[model samples]
Target: MTMIGAQLRLLAWFVIPATLLSGCAPAIRLDEAATDRPIQTSSAPPAAREDAPAPHRPPSPTPTPVPRAFALNLYQEGDFVPQYTFDWCVAASIQIMHNVIDDTGGGTWADRVQQGQLWEMARARSSNSFNGANPLGWAKVLTEVGMGPYAVVSIADYGEALRTAARAIADTGRPVGLVMWRGRHVWVMSGFTSLGDPDQFPKFSVTGIRVQDPLYPYGDQQWGPSPAPNALLTPEQLATQFVVREPRRWSSNLPTGYMLVLPVAKA
Candidate 1:
């Protein structure tokens, strides 16, 4: 009985120390789901911070572009007449102008009867004793025919003169009386081509003009091919015949350089 008791007491001492040591240390628990929890992360990228502000952006600017081309062919509308004689250019030009604004074909200024009347009226107001017709006289007659408020615009620069003429014609939808041959001859400006849109008038530049030279082919030696009545003339080509008015007994009162019988809006 004493030996059995001693063996049991030794076994109890060993078991107690092992149990106390394990209890003093940590307890380890095994979970089958723990490994999967770490690997089960989302496949999507990380979301942006909720408190972050958006970036700023500036506004786009507005556009203001010029046009490519523009033209107004009044002659093509059958509102032009050819001169009967070299000296009758003023009368013919006036007659053609009358046709344009004369919406009613009352035959008031049509044919030789009315043309002769206009010629005589122009001659009566002439500044030159030599030539019965002149720019001043032409303006006078035009005023009498209700196309008044016309201006005798003269510019030294050919390019500026073209812009002025283009703007006038575009605005009024009427022809401009171009004093050609050093103020000795007259031609009608019926249309024009522009680098910018002529329809935008006052805001464009002239590139070319369509002239209704009454003397045409007959005066080709003096003015190039006055082609088909309303001939397209470049600034260079026009400069050939559109020279400064020579000081003459007739054109003494006229301004030098390029001149035109510009029609203005009636006040």
Candidate 2:
């Protein structure tokens, strides 16, 4: 019985120590930052408070981007007549060669050549004949239009002219060339080709082909060499022949757009 009592006393001592140790455990504080203050409470004025002030959002709609006007250093000084880009630059060139021999208008080939009228008026006096009609007809039309034969076409490069026409007609927008394919002759380029890769330095380039074919007939009705020859004129050659021809006389200022007549024969 005494041993049993001793065992019971030992158990009580152990239980008392465990209870006292647990009572000495550290206290963990929660909700330390919590406060009873109302969410809206503030000392500053309503305007000065960050939450009270109204948000200054950017104005409703963004301004629209205005399109840049077409501009260039080259400008037309004389008078202007409408012209087509591709047909005149290409097909008309072909017709010009054909008309040279067909004698369609009783040796009036020169007249027909100048019939381009308002069309070829770009090159001051030089481009006039290429337009169509003879020098006399051109003069008559010039009088009628109140513009002299030496009128000026719009100040524009071949590329600009083509783009304007293409846009008007809903074209795919390819830079067209006045491809005058023939055997061997002086290449007269009046059109341009877009530089395929716009990222390149030169965004566009010129291509003027002279009308010469193996079958191309001279004034004597004699056949030339082979037909459909390679490009006869390089850009430099054309520049020397066409662009540099009396450069001081007329302004080569290329405008954003130009005018041209669709060559009737090619169409």
Candidate 3:
């Protein structure tokens, strides 16, 4: 009888615990419950545009800047003591030209050319035959220094080089003139004239403006107003002319038979 009573007590204990556990709700899963919460949605605020500057537009039909005689005098000093070698001078000039432009202000190539200080700096460096005669090579150097004009590759194309240079000159707003020397006589471009023949003396413009003065002995001439005179020369022409005419001229300080001066177009 006592054994039967003890067995009944043990069974009662097991049953009570089982029943209590089964009656309880699953421990509310906090992770799942949180996931059931709704997501909040609101439109993001628009970006601020208060401090933005206006976009820049390249000037079209820009004016060309003319170099003053005083500036020319800076280059005409001494018997052309060439500092720039054909290979090195052209490279150095392009770099220095762009640097000076950036130092003064950030604007189009025309803007830099118009600046007297930049012109003096460029002329001083480029005139030294130490640079190369190949303008395209010079363009490569210009790119490194951040003074590229975008269309500089045109120089590789004979017909396009002069036009490209002309356009760049015009954009620079500097003296839109060309300088050339037949022998020791240096002439400045004045204006273009339709010589009636587009071939030999092609129907184009001419550059010259002689100032009569004995003290100065002779004055420089300026040329311009033509839409396209550079069309005459092709890329092969430039390479051939510069390369063939005087293979050693560009490399040396001695005059390379002829000297051509090209200025930026008038702004």
Candidate 4:
């Protein structure tokens, strides 16, 4: 074979084999720009969590204020009756009670006598002497007249008695019979005052009391000066006349202490 022909045959043999091998192999591609960028491995996007804590909120406002002090003066609306005789205080007090409660459809009794008759009836019922009427007798007479259903509360604590009397007066709008001076005399409880509002009486401390004193300035010398009718009396002043449990000189069966005639529901 000629030399040129032999050289061309050898080149064709090398070139054809290389082209066939390249066609059989897989192609590999690379980008220079891709190597410069940061690799992001995660598929999820950035977002706030649903369970995260909420922002702060302002506090709620306070409720309405309550009253701290109060006073109830029932004396101005009540009737005042003076006892004719020293021992007739209970009768006189009952007369006053009748006058006040009569308008409210209470005080239904055939024996609505002013003083003498009531005194007699109380004395007879209680088995009391002519000296004076006893608390039991007074309460019994009031109950018999339909003016009651009265309770004879004998209490040793003065403050408790005062509270009870005030509550009774406020609830019934009737005078409370106060057995004063260790059962030597009787007075009426008409009203009261408190450190807290009167409407919230159960929550307050009683500061003062309005009383109807039948004896007034002319009380027995041994019992101290009687306060004027419908007088506003301090606890200290009341303590002067009011005493703890003591036996009575007239009645032997009566219970001792600060006694009161509290009206209750009929039957």
lDDT of 1 by residue, 120-229 (tens): 88988888868578888898888887877677777888888898888888788778899888766888888899888665545577778898776766775645556567
Better of 1 and 2 by lDDT: 1
Which stretches of candidate 2 lie above 4 Å from their native place?
1-194, 197-203, 207-232, 243-267
- lDDT tens readout by residue for model 4, 107-201: 43224354789988887776455555777788888888767878787777777778877777766766788778767788888778877664564
User: Candidates ranked by lDDT, best first?
Assistant: 1, 4, 3, 2
Best by TM-score: 1
By summed lDDT, which 10 consecutive residues of candidate 3 come out lowest?
A: 71-80
Worst 10 residues of 4 by lDDT: 105-114
Candidate 4's displacement at residue 108, Å, is 14
Error of 3 at 232 (Å): 21
Pick by TM-score: 1 or 4, better one:
1
- In candidate 3, stretches whose alpha carbon ends up further than 4 angstroms from where it belongs are 1-86, 99-134, 150-164, 174-267
Tell me how candidate 3 scores on lDDT: 0.32
Residue 22 displacement (Å), model 4: 23
Q: lDDT per model, in order? A: 0.78, 0.31, 0.32, 0.75
TM-score of each: 0.75, 0.25, 0.25, 0.69
